[model samples]
Target chain A: MKPMLAALVLLASLGVPLLAVAADPLASPGWPIAQNRFLTGKTYVFDDRVQVIVPRDAEDSTAVPGFVRVQGIPDVQQIMVFAELNPIPMIVQFWPHRLEPNIGFRFKVQQATPVRAAALGADGIWYIGGAWVNAAGGGCSAPSIASADADWAERLGEVHSRIWNRGDEGRRLRLTVMHPMDTGLAAGIPKFYLEELVLVDDADKHLGRVEVHASVAENPTLTFDLRTGGSVRIQGADNNGNRMLGEVE
Target chain B: MMPRLNALLGFYALLYGSFAAALDYQLQPREIAAGVYIFEGRQEHFTRHNGGNIVNTGFVITDAGVVVIDTGPSRLYGEQMRKAIATVTDQPPVQVFITHHHPDHFLGNQAFADVPICALPLTQKIIARDADALLDNMYRAAGAWMEGTEAVAPNCRAEAGKLTVGERRLSVLAVAGHSGDEASDLMVYDHRSGTLFAGDIVFHGRAATTPHANIQVWLQVLRDLERQQPQILVPGHGPTATDSRAIRETAAYLEWLDTTLREAAAAGLDMAEALELEIPERFKSLAVIDEEFERSVFHLFPAIDQEVLHGGAGNGTR
Candidate 1:
């Protein structure tokens, strides 16, 4: 009984089941862990014409491999898709259905997070693909354009978009917002953050919304595609009810 | 006890030798071109150990007064530059042009307190806000090399525009994409010598540093410089190369990086893998290729994607 008691005491000294000792691999100093935490549940099929390719180790921050395939989409046509986190959450959507079964683009991860891509097939089924990114540093918390509140306030409602013609019916549209999509990480003068909510709408239709991260670069630019010719509008508002709008043609 | 004492003395000597070696700052001033000089110094920091010597403080003796381009890394170095200039000319340096806000080029401005210093407006703002941080980094890097000195600061500022000194026409273009502040372009047209002082814009034998750099806009600025076609080019660092070939080479290097990194990014290659990929044939033999290439690639990969893929604006003017 003495020996058993002594063994128990040794175990206790070794910090077994101590509330203070938590198992957190990420908390270890200088240990390399996955920086991107993007997770995809299942490959969602939009239509028989569209094929989505998702990478296996999407958790790695430095690499994200993906492929997109769509049947009947003409080759040489522009392909547009949106990552769900865009202030519009539409990463890059473009028009004129290209026939190529594959399209690819490389993007920086603001954090270890998941990226969802939604492709609008010619048949109108939103094919969805997802990838995770492990990136270093809090990219979303990086500083953006330094402008006065009054100056940023004046350009609230103006939305602008530039549609590039890939030489034919294919069109690539790039959109930008004039609002500060404050991610609540930055300090404004008296230790306050410029937190705000922004919405992107196309022709009175709800496109998507993004929880603005402070790490986004100033004048957050979004490039996407649309099969239809219509105007897009962006609305932004801070917690204080300051609002601004912009339009793209 | 005697053996132990001998071992202890050996250890102390080893430590002292290392400390003394690091503290020694070797600065060599080479006359690369006629009436043009480059004060080449080593960056005494671990972060900048790429063997890319610090090329700060260049002097051009003009009919009016000596025109110094870039003020060395610190006040002491700046004084060294002034002394070097005095060896060649009796006239005081009337005007100083800061190529950018990098501490190695601008902190020494304090050495020329009496001389009027000029830089792009953006550079002035960056120096005003980030100079302290830059100096702290320098001090930490120099360690024993700067054992007995305080960091110096820039005194005068230059608005972005044109200024004429002697027969030279200096134009401060607001080139950005390198630092938040500092001109992307510093075009000095020396009518007498037909030379253009192309700051850090063109590196002759080494890959360019891309921290806080905008590759696309930098390429555009190079194109603009090429169009001017100055007879001689005096780079901010390294030996000057004649004609716009250096400009083309620098642009080509950037383009290769842009395309290669873009492909790697598209393929979902990790940053480390991308860096490990064999360097192109063009840049294989350049000095500091292996030492600094990785860092340049790391900074440039994301910057290029931001500008080209994301449609981010060029680095200059906000």
Candidate 2:
């Protein structure tokens, strides 16, 4: 979603129409959005250079495949994924240190939502790509069908992060976390999910920026475009203030 | 004579085509144990090509009458199974045991209309609750295969206890079938032959479906069954095993999934990332890992996420 349209969707989804108050969260937001310093006052454009690929129809609601590609850019700074229909629509803000403008990943889609991937470049301008995906819509509410084993309790919160070269100039950073990403919509299911995610270098320098929406799907997956081969680390917290950290090579 | 031969061949071809078209898949029974015959189903989900023939059925020949364990995916399958069983035994299936409430296991109940169809009380209740929807889904997935199919609830409750079938005494253990604490699965053990009819509990090479299952209890039950030393194992979807190896195999896979999901959750990866995970070398050999495992992650990740969010004491929200 472009900056204006992302804000435009906020107006449509939350029914709050305001131009002056759209700059910051405290001023006024269409909804409750996680505060971000980088997103302030940015005019986003519908750029053909950016392409967001998502199946028009989701085969599986939870782990629906998606990708973002930024053409004509050698070094892209950040990519942000958004599910316009989700209660929390900021799927993830990704920073790629190796530095390509392309990434592929998957997340949940609740109903038919405009899945938007916004690419930020060195020009400080934001380019947006989007697709309308018609999902059966249980990504958030459906029960996780992984295992019924009692031992799975001890294995929770584990992360398996990997970086596979795209064979082009960029690489794919894939990580799997054990989380339900529950939306509390299902009967008796509470809203338990990851609330924050951060990408950093060895020195803890923020590589890219990201924010996740409740529609991120359970056991969320984050994929990023890596332009260079460098050491990177990921750290995040869930709603209960539980924190996790991982590194990808 | 040549014209007559050609005419005879044409008549036979029409007969063969109609018969083959109606009974698309043969219900070939393989005797897994003494008086125990089984029909191994294909390792695939319900699709038009498969005709919903993705369930295993077993028939036990007793001195008094025959006892059938699980009807196949459709009424036609059950009819074919009955005909196949009759070829080996004179007695008809006096009683039919519905392993669980899965459409593939119980939709064939119409063919067993004459006999008492038994299921766990919870299974019957679930069947009753989701009958119309499940049937509708089956029809949508496999149109012609589900033509004669109807959702039939078990009239008799299959309680966990010892029961006599002719001269043989069978131990019917009610096992926790789903994470919901419903006896969604049943283990029928024949002490006489040491054969364990593990319905949907022990998937050897076949991938177990997790739509309505509790993996924790299932793993524990498989461990217990392994220790009991069943001579022959008859799973709901895979080839029968002579040893308790099937139990161990199924338990190991669930354990692997437990570890994978736990690690992924801890790292805060989303379901999509987890779904893209590479199957371990050991699990790569397992059938349906490609199709079944991803679906399972979608189904199982939610509950696990809730478990961790609540600090392992799950909120019982699921």
Return the top candidate by lDDT.
2
* DockQ per model, Cα: 0.04, 0.07
In terms of DockQ, the best-performing candidate is 2
For residues A227-249, what per-residue lDDT tens digits would candidate 2 score against the true structure?
Answer: 44677787878887778887877
Candidate 2 residue-wise lDDT, B185-268, digit = tens:
877888788888888888878767777667777777887888886888888877888887777878888888877887776554
- The best candidate by TM-score is 2
Displacement of the residue B36 alpha carbon in candidate 1, Å: 2.8
lDDT scores of the candidates, listed in order: 0.53, 0.72
Model 1 chain A: weakest 10-residue lDDT segment is A30-39
Question: Positional deviation of B46 in candidate 1, in angstroms?
Answer: 6.1
Model 2 bad stretches (over 4 Å):
A1-249, B1-23, B177-182, B316-318
Q: Report, in order, each candidate's fnat.
A: 0.00, 0.06
Q: Worst ten-residue run, lDDT, model 1 chain B?
A: B43-52
- In model 1, the Cα lDDT at residue B126 comes to 68
- Each candidate's TM vs. the true structure? 0.54, 0.63
